[model samples]
Target chain A: MQHLLATHPRRRLFQLSPPATKPSREGVFFLPSIRIGLAVLALGGLGAGSLALAQEPPAPSPERSRELIRMVRQDCGSCHGLTLRGGLGSPLLPETLRDKPPDGLKHTILLGRPGTAMPPWKTFLNEAEADWIVAQLLRGFPEESK
Target chain B: MRKALRAWCWAILAFLPLLAWSAEPTLRGTGDLGVIIERSAGRVLIVSTSSNSIISKVEGLGDLSHASVVFSRDARYAYVFGRDGGLSKVDILRGTLEKRIVQGGNSIGGAISQNGRLVAVANYEPGGLKVFTADTLEPVADIPAAYGDNKLSKVVGIADLPGDRFIYSLFDADQIWIADLRDPKAPKVEKFSNIGKAPYDGLVTPDSRHYMAGLFGEDGIALLDTWQPEQGVKRILANYGRGEEKLPVYKMPHLRGWAVAGHQVYLPAIGRHEVLVADTIHWKETARIAVRGQPVFVVARPDGRQVWVNFAFPDNGFVQVIDTLSGKIVQTLEPGKAVLHLEFTPRGETVWASARDDHKVLIYDTASFAKLAELPADSPSGIFFTSRAHRIGF
Candidate 1:
C-alpha cells in the first residue's frame, strides 16, 4: 500500500461528476474524473497514490421524509430523468417501491444489487437514514423535502 | 397493480443513493481493492467498486430473479445493461445510477478505451459494432459487421486495450476484427484472420502485445501476435478432446471465455471443465487444470494467482473455481440457474456473480469461498463493479 501511495500520482479531475459537465475521460472505458489520478499513476507503470472521492452521510435534517425524497430524486433521477420517470434506469416515481415495506426498501438502498446497475450503499448511508427515506417514499415527500 | 409496485420500488431505491451518497464519508484507496459483500442478514449487497471505499446500493437490485450489469473501463462507472438494451451508469463513489442511456437496438458486449475516448458496443439483432464518444455520449461510428453473411458471422464481444484501438470476435465467421479509433471521426476497421473454425472470445494482454483468442468450434485457443495480427504464432490448442483430430464441422467443442490479468491469460474450456493457461510473456500454452462444468467466463485475480469461472445454461448452476498455479478446478460454487457473469474486487477479496434467470447477484467470500449473500438485479447481463462507482441511470 505504501509503495503505491508513495508513487501515486495526484489525479486532478476530482469526482466522477467533475466540474466539466461534458465529463471527458481517460479513455472510452475509464470514468473521466477518477482516471485523471489513475492515468497519471498508470503512467510508465508507476502506479501510485490511492484516493476515494465522495462525501459520506449523517445527512443534516430536512426530516427523514425530506431526505428520502431527496435520495429517491438523486438515485432515480441520476439516470432516469430526475423526475423519476424513466430513462436508462427504470421508472421509480412512487409506483415501483411503494409496495415494498420501509425495511425491504432500505435493503435495496443500502445493499447495491449485483447483476444490475444498482450498487449497494450501506457504506454510503446509515440504516436509520435509509429507513427514513423509505418511509417517506412509502407515504409522500412534501415540497419542503426537496 | 404489479406495474405500480414495480415503479415504486425503482423510485425508492433510486432516490436513496442520491441522498445517501451525496452525504457519504470520504474514502481514499488505502492500496486495498474494494469488493462485493452482504450485510444485515444478506438483504443488502454492498459493492465497494468505486474509487471511494464506499458502496452505493439500490433496493431490489439483486432480487434473485435475473439481472445484467456492465462496467466502464476502470470500473468507476457501472451500467446495468438490461433487457431491451436498457443502460444505467452508476456513480460507484455515491453508489447511485446517475444516467441511463436507452439504446435503440440490442447490445451484447461493450468495451471502453483506456483514455475514455470511446465506448464500443457490440450489438446483436442489428448485427454491428456501435461506437460512442464516452465523454460526449455521441455516436462516433457504427461499423456494420458480417452477422448474417449466410448467417455465418455474429459479433460476440468487443475489447478496448491500452491504446485507442479495439478487437472484436465474430461468432461463426472464422475471423476477428481490430478497429482503429485514432481519429474518433474516421475509424479504420481491419479484419484479423481467424486461426480456427469458430473464435468465440479473446483477451488482450495488459501490454496489448498479444490477443489470446478462444475457439469454441475448434478444440483450443489461437495465440495471435497483435503486432503481426494478419499473421500469427498460429493456433495453440488447449488440448481439449482426445488426441488432436480437430473438431467436427458441426460441433462446438472448445467453449472458452478468454480473459487476461496483468500478464497471464486464462482460457475457460467447457469440454474439460478446466482453465487452460498460457505464459503471457511468451504467449505459449502453459497448463490446463480441471474445474467444474461448463465454465464460460474467466476472470483473473489482480495478482493473477486465481481465475474465477462462471458457467452458463447447462451444468445446473455452478461457478467453477480454478487455481492458477496448479491450473486445476479448486471448487465449484452452486449459485443456481443461468449464471451469466463473474468478477472479483480489485483486491481479489470477494467474488460477485449474476444469474440470468435468477435475477440475482450472488456474493461470495473470496477468502472463505462461501455462498455469502445475494442482491436483486433487473435483467442484468455482463456484470462489472468498479472500485469507483459513478452515478449511472437508464
Candidate 2:
C-alpha cells in the first residue's frame, strides 16, 4: 500500500481526502493494495495539472471503444434514457454531470452507489474502462455509429 | 330559361370529378391500430394488427428512449409519454401528432383514467403526478410526491383503477399512493408508508383488484389490495433470495409485464435467473421456474395457456415460453439481438417483439412458433396496441 501510494503522490492525496471525511468510504481505503491501485487508476486518470501526467494505462483499441460506447448507450441508457436525459435514473448529460467530480463518478461506475438502483459494473468493466466512460460522459458522450 | 339551368348543372357535374381528383381522405377504423416507439428517431410507426403491417409513421416526439403509449377510450388517439417530459397525443388514424405538451422535466410513464377522461403522468425530476384532461392536454391537477422535510420521491408503477383512481408506488419514500380523481379539481390521495425497499415498477391485476410493485432494494414484492386500502400493503415472496448470492443485475426487471395465468401469477425474480410463480388465491409462492437469464418481462397469452419470458442484456437475445399447465420451459428461440419489449395481439393469436439492435419488429404465430413477418423500424422498443384502451391496466 505504501509503495502504491508513493508512486502516485498527487493521486494518493486527492483520493485520501474524500475517505477521510466520508466514514462509509473509510472501509474502501483499507482494502487490498490491488484494489487501491485500481481505484487510483480509475480516479486519477484525468486529475492532473497536465493531461500527460494523468496515469492512463494501456488505452483500449479503436474497435473495443465502440463496443464500450454501445454498451453505455443502450445498457446504461436503459435507465438514463436513450438520449442520456433523465428517466428513473438521473440524467447522464454533460450539464447534469458537470458539477460532479470525475473521481467520484468513476467510483460510482466501478462500485455502485449503495441504497440506490445503480448496480456495480466492476465485473463487466475494468478501472481504465470506467475512467474512460467518465471522461466521455463529462464531455458529451459520443453517439453510436450506425 | 331551361337551357341556362341545364348549362349550370353541366358545370356542377364537371367540377365534381375535379374535386375528387384533387384530394380524397381515406377512412379507416382504429380497432386494430397500434403504435411502435422508434426510440432513436423520436418517431412512431402507426401499425395495423389485422393486416400485420405498418400503415404510416409519425415523428417529432422528443426523447422517446423510454416512451410508453396509452390509448384514448375511442382508441383513435394514443397518449405517448416520453422520457423528456413530452406528452404527445397522436392521431393514429390520420398518422399525425394531434397535441403535445412538455409538462414536466423528466417523466417516466402515464395511465389514462378509468372513464378515459383524465391522464396522469409519473415524473422523476420535480417528482410528482400530474393529471391532464384527455382531450386538449389541459392540466387538471398536480400532486407532488413530497415526503419528509422537502424531499420528493420518484413515483413509479402508475395504473388506473375501476373508479377514477390512480395507484402508484413511491421509490424513495417506500410508499404506495392511490389518488381518487372522481373530482378532478381535488384528488383524494390515500398513502401507505414503509411498504418496503425501492418499489421500482408496478402492475394492476387484470381484474383491477390488486396492485403489485416489484422491489429492487430487497428480495420481495409489495402487494396492495386496491379494493381494501385500509388493509395496508403486504410483503409477499419475502426473502426468496436469502441463501443465494444475488447476481449482478445489468438491467432492472420490469413489473408491468407481469403475467397472471389461471390461478398462478408469474413474476420476474430480480437479480436471479428464475421466474416466481405464486398462487393468486392465497398470494403464496407455489413454484420457482429456473430460466436462462434474469427475466425482464413475463407476459401471459390472452388465453393464459402460455407465458412468454424475455431477459435483460447478455441473455436478452433469447426468449423462452412456459407452459402454464405444466409449468415447464417448453421452447426457447433466438429472436434477435437486444429484444426490448413484447406485445401479444388482442386475442393472443400472434405476438410482436421489438429488437432494438436489429432495428426490426419480429412477428410470430404463437401456436406454430414460426416467424410470421418482419417489419423495419428505427431502433424500436415498446409495441402497444389499441386494444389496451379498454383494459384496466395497460
Identify the leading candidate in terms of DockQ.
Answer: 2
**Candidate 2 lDDT, B156-199, residue by residue in tens:** 99999988899998988999999999999989999999999989
* Interface C-alpha root-mean-square deviation of candidate 1: 18.7
Give the distance in Å from residue B366's predicted Cα in candidate 2 to where it truly belongs.
0.6
Q: Point to the candidate with the largest TM-score.
A: 2
List clash counts for every candidate, in order.
108, 0
**Clash count, predicted structure 1:** 108
Candidate 2: residue pairs that collide: none
The per-model lDDT (C-alpha) reads: 0.52, 0.84
Report iRMS values in order: 18.7, 9.2
Candidate 1 residues B38-119, lDDT tens each? 2111122334433323254543222111123434545555444432333445555555546656553344356666566676
